[model samples]
Target: MSRKRLYLRAGLYAEGRSDYDFLLPLLNRLLSSLASSLFPGACDVEDSLGIDAPYPAPSERAERIAAAIADRRAECTLFVIHADGAGDPRYARQSCLDPGIDAARRASPDVVTVPCVPVRETEAWLLVDAEVFRPWLGSDAHSALPAEPEREADPKLTLGRLLKVKEGRMRRKPERLYRLFGEEVSLEALRALPAFQLFEAELVEAIRAVARSQGWPR
Candidate 1:
């Protein structure tokens, strides 16, 4: 197979550390997954704000990114972002969704942007992949996981509760989820989630369009 390479400049602005961390590795894996099979080759991501870098304020993120990209302060031809939908998807987009999209476009008219919101929380993506969670929750607590995770009001709460259940106690620690989703979860399983689907579709199409514009063959 002939592989095409995109000198991609990726920019990311996320709501929190966990999502920031989860978003980077997950995105790399996802890009690789899509590239090797779906497209011609690989997308090498370049972002001045490293994948593990700190995030800007949610409100100013779009404005900052637009300025950065325009000035080459942040170098990326494309931007991938993650911000919580927080209990309302409506507010989530207003806060960052439209702005992020607009900023990337303004920065580089052709730059492709994919901004993701986890509905209520990023933890919800983990639940879409049952097999991954089935192991983490163990056999005993496996039954406790929801069949339709997106329906749960606070999937993050369910994740925390499930972890606590495994240890035979309840605790409000967010680090556990941070570790589980960051370290052990599978991206392939995450493909089942609607959020992931939106991300994947947008990202793939962006690459394809960019490739066509750059005249790269698949």
Candidate 2:
């Protein structure tokens, strides 16, 4: 009997450059967990294509998605698109993610696309786990976090207030802070958020679709 080998290649189009620092690690962790459960005993390899530049205008998103698909259609099995649900989650999904994903699917029907639209902003997701702040703020980290952080109008501002540093002390850069939060934040807490739950469900379905198409053992 031969052991099966599975290669999972993912492409990420983040809304901001700082998002990569957080999302890359978060996505990798999710993939690792999924692979362990879904393809136990198989040799699983993972790769990712990161889009680090500024997001294109909404009008250009479809063309950009199609071009990205064309560029790595052979290697990429999944594409995760990030769009901040600022003010209106519905509008963001319709205007920012749906059209692009539809166009991409039309061009490369085999590839699976997942939308990651964090309510308000990605910072909202980081606010769910208060323990993630202890390392930076010590006992003073006991500030009250929002009950429903996703509904907060400006989660970034709220996070900044909670993590404020004293004058003359150097503050951690946003990218590094986001990466730290990503690595340490509890996934269980994240799942409590409606937006995160939706994203995770879609991601799981996308992975299952890819696995079925590839005939990889479940």
Candidate 3:
């Protein structure tokens, strides 16, 4: 008797507009686009929760999301999305799963977890960007820096140093995503990268699988 529902877990611990700069918009677009392509709008997509604040901890974030879903009192499919960082992605996922697991045991199984490629998984994207800025750095790309700068210097040197100096900055944040792509590139670019695309495609499949398992929409 309840309408079908879909839950999206987004990661927003980065610079730029939390949802757009991070993963929510992309995930929503992918799921909606895929659903329309496959089912031609036969099903409706509703969010169980919207992320409005910065969460200090993933477990707390997961708990808040779980509470929102319970308040809806609707049967739904869940998809959790997050970037792997210094914190354990597995722990973040397990934390999200705990509440859903309990909910499912008391009700029905409808939650699925998918972890995206770590910075290591997408190293080529970083290498590509580095090569673009390398020429301007010249020998300075590897040179040691003065303790402090007295005057303005080349911008490329600053970027080169960031790429070399910050061991994890380029790797961890969602903003780096734009660095890999040209503005002209369509959303398809993410789908082109097996490292990036597979995670999303598989996530959709997981949601579909859960929905089917719940006997939703026949």
Q: Which candidate is the best by lDDT?
A: 2
Q: Best to worst by TM-score, what's the order?
A: 2, 1, 3
Model 3: per-residue lDDT, tens digit, 22-107?
35544555556666665563556553333322344235554544443444334345544443322343464465445443543354
Backbone collision tally, model 1: 1
Query: Scored by CA lDDT, what does every candidate get?
Result: 0.63, 0.79, 0.43
TM-score for each predicted model, relative to the true structure: 0.74, 0.89, 0.44
Candidate with better lDDT, 1 vs 2:
2
Clashes of each: 1, 0, 0
- Shift of residue 137 alpha carbon in model 3, Å: 16
**177: Cα error in model 1, Å:** 5.0
Top model number, TM-score: 2
Where does candidate 2 have its weakest 10-residue lDDT segment?
Answer: 50-59
lDDT leaderboard ranking? 2, 1, 3
| lDDT per residue (tens digit) for residues 27-67 in model 1 | 66566566667554465654324332235423466665555
Q: CA shift at 74, candidate 1, in angstroms?
A: 6.3
Tens digit of per-residue lDDT, candidate 2, span 26-96: 88887777766777766364756785223543348777766666666766778898899996877999998
